[model samples]
Target chain A: MNRVKSKYLKGKEKFAIGIDLGGTNIKIALVSKAGAIRNYLKIPTNTQQGKEATITRIKQGIYQIISQSNLETRSISGIGIGAPGPLDFQKGIIHFAPNLPGWEEVPLAEIIKEEFKIAVKVENDANVAAWGEKTFGIAQGVDELVCLTLGTGIGGGLIIGGKIYHGKNNVAGEAGHIVVNKDGPLCNCGNFGCLEAYSSASGIKNRVSRRIKELKISDPSIFYQNNFDQISLVKIFEQAREGNPIVKDIVEEAIEYLGIGITTLVNLLNPEMVVLVGGITNEGDKLLNPVKDIVFHRAMRYHVADLKIVFGKLGEYAGVAGAAALLWDFD
Target chain B: MNRVKSKYLKGKEKFAIGIDLGGTNIKIALVSKAGAIRNYLKIPTNTQQGKEATITRIKQGIYQIISQSNLETRSISGIGIGAPGPLDFQKGIIHFAPNLPGWEEVPLAEIIKEEFKIAVKVENDANVAAWGEKTFGIAQGVDELVCLTLGTGIGGGLIIGGKIYHGKNNVAGEAGHIVVNKDGPLCNCGNFGCLEAYSSASGIKNRVSRRIKELKISDPSIFYQNNFDQISLVKIFEQAREGNPIVKDIVEEAIEYLGIGITTLVNLLNPEMVVLVGGITNEGDKLLNPVKDIVFHRAMRYHVADLKIVFGKLGEYAGVAGAAALLWDFD
Candidate 1:
C-alpha cells in the first residue's frame, strides 16, 4: 500500500505541501492535484524554544514529508502554511501568534520557499482549514459559504464564488470578533461582547467555571480540582445527554450566543451554506438543531429560507486536505 | 448635439436600458459598457392612481426613451429596473414597495419585457444601486464591494467577486436592520436598536424631532407639521455645518452609529472598497472622517489597512447608471 502510494506521488508535476502549524504540533503533508495526501509527517512545535527554533523545526518537518515521497522537489508547485495569527499574509509573515511563543512577524513562508525552491502562500489557519472543507469536505460543491471553527478562539473563513474572500488586507472573515452582545463579557480581542467570548471552547469553559464558582455547586469538580483535567466538551456532552441541568444550561447559553453570531452572518453575507467545524461541533445536532432554530427565528424570513447549517465532514484531516487543495488550484 | 449623442449611442451593440422607479418620479436612461449615461428622462410615478396606472406610466417612460434614442430596440440587450422592495427578483415581481401605494407582487419586469419584446431583469432599488456603484460609480474596478444607501431606510448591497450576493434568499444587504444596540431604540422592523433606527434619514429626523419634543424646544415643527413637505437631509446638513448644537449632536451620534455599522461590514465582508451613496453621504468628509476613524480604531487592524471608503460620484443618477451597467453584462 505504501509503495503504491509512493509510486503514484512520484509522477505528479505540480505537487504542493500543506503545513498546519498548531500550538502543540507541526503537521506537514505532501498534497497532489487530486486532493490526495501523498505523504505526511508530524512533529512537536516546541513553542517554548522560541521563534527561530520553531521555524527550523517546521522546515525539518517539511523535509521529512518530502523525503518520504518519491516526488522531485522541482515539480512541487507551491507550499501553503496555515498558522495561528494575527498575520500579514501579503508579506507572508506572522504578526503575533499566542499559540506559537516568541513568534513575531516571522517571515516563515519566505524562508520555507527560499530553502525549498517552491512558491509559498500563508493564511490564517482557520481560513486554510475552511479552504480544506470547501475543497474536500461538506462545502465541496457550494460557491458561497462561511465556515466557523469553534475552538479556543472562534475562527471563521469566507468562501465566495469557490475562492476565499480574504477581504481588503487578508483580514476578512473575523466573524468571531463581531459583537453579538454589546453588554456581554469582555472578549480577549479587547472588545466587549464578541461572539468568541461566548461560543468558543474556552468561552464555554469559562462560563461553566464561573457558574460553578458562583453557585457553589457540589458536583464533580473533575474539571476544577485538576485544572479541568477531564472537563472537556466530550464529557460535557455526555452530561447533557444524561440530563444534567448545569451542563445543559452552559451548552444552551453557548448555543444561544452562537445562534446570534450565525444570524449576523446570515443577514450580512447571505451564504448558501454555513459549515460548523472543529472539536466542539462534534456535539452534532444537539448543538446544530438549537443553533439553526434560533438563527431561523431571528433572521429575516427571506434570508433564512435557503440557508443550510451542517457540520463539517472532513474531521481532523481538513488542514492538510486544504493545503493539498491549494496545489489543485495551480493545476 | 442630440444628433451627435445619438450617433455615439448607435455604435454600441451592448447597450442596456435602466429604469429607476422612484416614489414621485421614474428616471430612465440608456447606459454604455463604459458606465456612461448616454441619455436619460425623468417622468412622474403617479402612484396615487394605483399599480396599473403606475405600470402604464413606467411603460410610457420606457417608450419615450426608446423612441427618442437612435439606438434600435434590437440592439438594446436587456432592460434592468431598480425599485423599492420587498421584491421577488427571480420572478421579476415587486412584492411590497412602500413608496408605490397598493403595490404588491407587481410583475413590472415581465410586463415591460412582454410589451417591448425585450429581456428585463428586476432587482431591489438598493441592490441595483449597489450594482451601479460597483460597476460604474466610486467602486468602479473593484470586484468585491459593498454599497450603503442612506435614505429613508438604510439600504445596502454586496457585490462579491463582481456579482451581487443576494444572501440565501434575495434579502442580503439588509445591514440597516442589523441590531447595533440592544437598548437603543425601537425600529419599524420590530427590532430594537437596529443601525437603521439610528443612522437612516428618517431615523435621524425621528431622533431630532423626539429630542425637540422631549426638551419642548420651540423649533419650527417642520418634521411634524408638513408630512409631505419632505424633511430634506440638506436642511440638517446646513444646520450641522452652521454648528447648531442640537443638529451637530444628532449628526455626530448618527456618524458614530454609522461607524459602528460600517465596522461590522468591514469585519464581516472585508471587501476591497466600501462605497457610501445617498443624501447622508453628502455630509462628505464630516461623516466620512468620523466613520473612517472609528472603523479603523475598532476593526481588526489588518482588515482596516487596505480598506478604502469613498463617496459615490454618480450622485442621483447612480440607480439608473447601475441599472444601465446591468445591460453591459447581460447585453
Candidate 2:
C-alpha cells in the first residue's frame, strides 16, 4: 500500500503493470522494479457481465492505475497478468479456468497487448504467487520451494531450480489434487480424497456444515447467525480452539490432512521451503505450526533437515506483485 | 545381460565401476562411457558376517569385474555405488540403510577411494535407478520422468531437467513412502498406508500369505507348496487372473493401489514418463496396462496428454548399469 519509492531504484525508474484477474475482482497495480507499489486499483470482475465486459473492466483497472501514477504505458517495462489457469503461458492464452465461466482459450495477453502496445505475459495464479514469494516475499532467494494458495480451493506453485516448473502440459503444480486419504471425501475435481477435499476453505466448511446438521447444533451465535459462507476461517478456527465439538474435529482433521498433503509434497520434491498464502493463512500460527509439526514429524528425516514451512510475506499483493514480478529479473 | 560392447565405444574406451550394494548381494559391473556393461560380477553380501566383511565382499566384486574386463583401476573414470539410502552423496556416506543393518554412516566412498585412489560417488539406489533410466534405459532423452522400482519394496527416483533431483537432503525421491491409501495398512517405515505397504513384492506376498490362512485355502500348488517367499509375483498375478478368490482380491487391490500411487505421482510431478522396474515388473503388460489405464484416466487431462507409463529397458541390469551411469554424462 506504500507509495514511497525505494532508494535503490535510483537510476532511470522502471515500472511494470501487474493485473490479478480473479473471478470476483480485478486487481491492478503499478509496481516498481524493486517490488514497490506506486499505484493500486481494485474493481469488481462482474463475470455476470460476460467475458468482453470483464476484459474491459480489466483494461479499465489497468488504465485507472496507470492514470493514477501519471505514467505512460510506453514507460512501463511490460504488463504481467496472474489469471486462473490451465493456461498456455507460451501462447499467452487461458485454456480454461475453473473459477471463470465462459472463458475458453482466451487470448488475454494479445488483447491486453493490442490495447496498450506493450509486451504482456500471462501466468497461472499459483505460479505467479510462487514467483512473487520467490522474488520479493518470504521465500526470496529460496531455490527449491512450494508455495500454496489456501483459499476456497487449494492451489500450489512449485519452484524447482529457482524457476516455475511448468510440467509437460503447463499444469504441473496441482498440489490440491494430491490424494491424502484415498477413501476420504470427493473433491470438486471428481477425485476422491484430494487435499482440497480435506483442507481447503470450502472443504472445511462443507464438512463443518454437514457435521453441524448431523449433530443438530442450532447454535446461531456460534456460527454468526449461521451465515457460514460469509464467515471467516479465523472464526471457525477460533471455534475449534474454544472446543466447539463439530468445528474441533473437522478443523483438526483439515489441518492434519493439510499437513499430510504437505508431507507428501516435501517427500516427493524435497523443497527447501513451503510458503503458505491466501485466506486460510489468516489463521496464521494456528494453521502454520500444526501443519509444520505434522510435516516435520512425518516427512523423512533428511527431507526436513532444512525444510522451512511458513507463510508468504507478500499477503494479498502476491498475486498482482508476482504477476508484475514475472516481467523483471530477480537479482 | 548382453556382453556385446557397443561398436561406438571406440578409440580410447572409458569405463566406470558401478556397485549395487544390496542387503543379500553385491553386484558390480564395468560400464563403458556409452552405458554398456563390459563385465559384471555378483556375490553374496553376508551381512551376518559384519559391515567390514560386506565391504570386503564389495571390494572383491569390484576387483573381479575389473579383472574380467582386463582394465586397470587408474584407467577407470570413476566409481558410482547405488546403495539403500539415507546416503550422503556429497560425503559418500551411508546413513544407516534399512535393508543393510549395521551399515550406519559408513564412508564407503572414502574407504573405497583410499583403496583404489579413484573418485567415488554414493547415491541413493532409487536415484541411481532414475538416473539409469534417464541416461541409458527406457527414459532416455526424457527430461521429466519418475522411475519406480517395484521390488521387495517400492522406490522412486525422479529425473527433473534430466538430472537426479536429490531434494534438500538427498532423500527426496521416497515415493514408496507416499501415503496412497491413508487408511490402508501399516508400512515397515512406521507409517500407515504407504505405497510400499500396498504394492511392493513383500507387501503383496505378506497379504497373500495372511489371506491364504484366513480363507483356509489349503491349495499347496497355488502357492508353490507353501513356499510363498520363493514364489514369484507372476504366479500370484496368474492366480489372480485365474479368479482364485483369496489371491484375486488382494492382487487386484495391490495393482489398484499401485495404480493409485502412480496416479498420485503423475498428478503431483506432471512428469513426461513413468518407468516401472524390478521384480514385480515380470508381470509386464498385465501390470503396465492396468497402471497406464488408471493414471491416464485418473490424473489431470493435461498431465496424461502425452504421459508415457512404461517398463524400464535395462531389466535386472538397471541397478548396476544405473549406478555406473551416475559417473558419465548423457549427451
Write one digit per residue (lDDT tens) for candidate 1, span A1-331.
0223445545544578888889887888887766777787888888889888988898787777777775567656778888887787777898888787788878977898889887888888888888998887888778778999888899898887677877666677888887766567777776667788888887777777777778788876544435545457666667666878777776776788788778778877778899898888878788899999877877766677788999888777788778656655631
The two-chain DockQ for each candidate, comma-separated, is: 0.46, 0.64
Encode model 1's per-residue lDDT on B1-331: one tens digit a residue.
Answer: 0223456555644678999998878999987777778779988888889888888888887777777777677767888999887687888888787788899878888899899898898988888888888777777778778888898888888887678877556777888876676556788766567788889998988888777768788754443435545555667767777887767778777888788778778877787888888878767787899898877877676677788888888898899988777666531
Would you list the C-alpha lDDT of every candidate in the order shown? 0.78, 0.84
List A-chain TM-scores for all predictions: 0.91, 0.94
What TM-score does prediction 1 earn?
A: 0.83
Q: Which candidate gets the maximum DockQ versus the true structure?
A: 2
Clashing pairs in 2: none
Fnat, one value per model? 0.56, 0.64
How many pairs of residues in model 2 come into backbone collision?
0
Residues A1-331, model 2: lDDT tens digits: 2244444245677889888889888889998878888888888988888889999889888888876776666678899999996899988999988788899999999999999899899999999999999988898889999999998999899998888988777888999888877678878877788889889998987887777778777763565434644655666788899998768888999999898888889878889999999999888788889988888877777788898999998998999899999898775
List candidate 2 stretches off by more than 4 Å.
Answer: A1-13, A72-74, A209-239, A242-247, B1-10, B209-235
Candidate 2: CAPRI quality band: medium
